[model samples]
Target: MTKPLKASGFLGLATMMVVGLYQFTLLAGGNAVPGWMIGGHAHLGVISILAIVMGFAVPVIGVTGRLRTAVTGMFIAGQWGIPGVVWIGEGAELPFLMPTAFLWGICLIVSMLIMLYATLTQDSSGIGGEATGVTPADD
Candidate 1:
């Protein structure tokens, strides 16, 4: 994988971690978190899993156009959707959580855009290179 794609994948995983932690905190604190928050967390979790799966599946298939685009789109949508649901829909009042959520959203958005570019421009040739059955590069 190219540097940007690797970075994007890491950022995507980070966003997933943030979403999961946020949900777990909410649930564990017994604050009656909104159903939308739970749903949003679930959505982000699914996106994260998809990213991981595609990261492996793409190079395995040796075809890397449509699936990449779809994953990028889903990542962008989930990143924005989570914040929209939390801040706008639920109106969460925790000031400290806001910054983390905002940063996570921004990272996810930028990373998704970069990944989308890599996907469209054929720059991430080895994105799924370690999915087994493929020769590993010496470098």
Candidate 2:
């Protein structure tokens, strides 16, 4: 699970770098890329970072087994799906896909929420016997 998420993140970053250079070239040529394309690129970058962060967070938070799989899958799907729909919709001039992209966004949000809830609900020892909360230094 962690491997796939991290891989996706790295892949997304690579893709972003390529698209960003393309966008730069377009701007340099005095060709205006659509606002929606720019928006999709930004989303791709952010979601990619989120995926990488979540990959590291998963093990530390002790979201193991099937639950971890589900959460990881959600993040991965959002990482790919959101901007994909946007790029496809705008590039193809099919505007309807814009609204549908929100569904993928929800997956990303809910996955984070699950991580938060798991962290907060754990006992003082936390999951896998690791501390989930901060401990102040003795004065």
Against the true structure, whose TM-score is highest? 2
Q: Over 4 Å off in model 2, which ranges?
A: 126-139
Per-residue lDDT of candidate 1, residues 35-120 (tens digit): 66666566566555555654554454443467455545555555555555565545665445545555556655665565556567
| Candidate 2 RMSD to the real structure | 4.8
Question: What's the lDDT for residue 7 in model 1?
Answer: 46
lDDT of 2 by residue, 15-52 (tens): 98899999999999999988877988999998899888
Each candidate structure's count of clashing pairs: 0, 0
Please give the lDDT score at residue 125 for candidate 1: 57
Relative to the true structure, candidate 2 reaches a TM of 0.85
RMSD of each: 9.0, 4.8
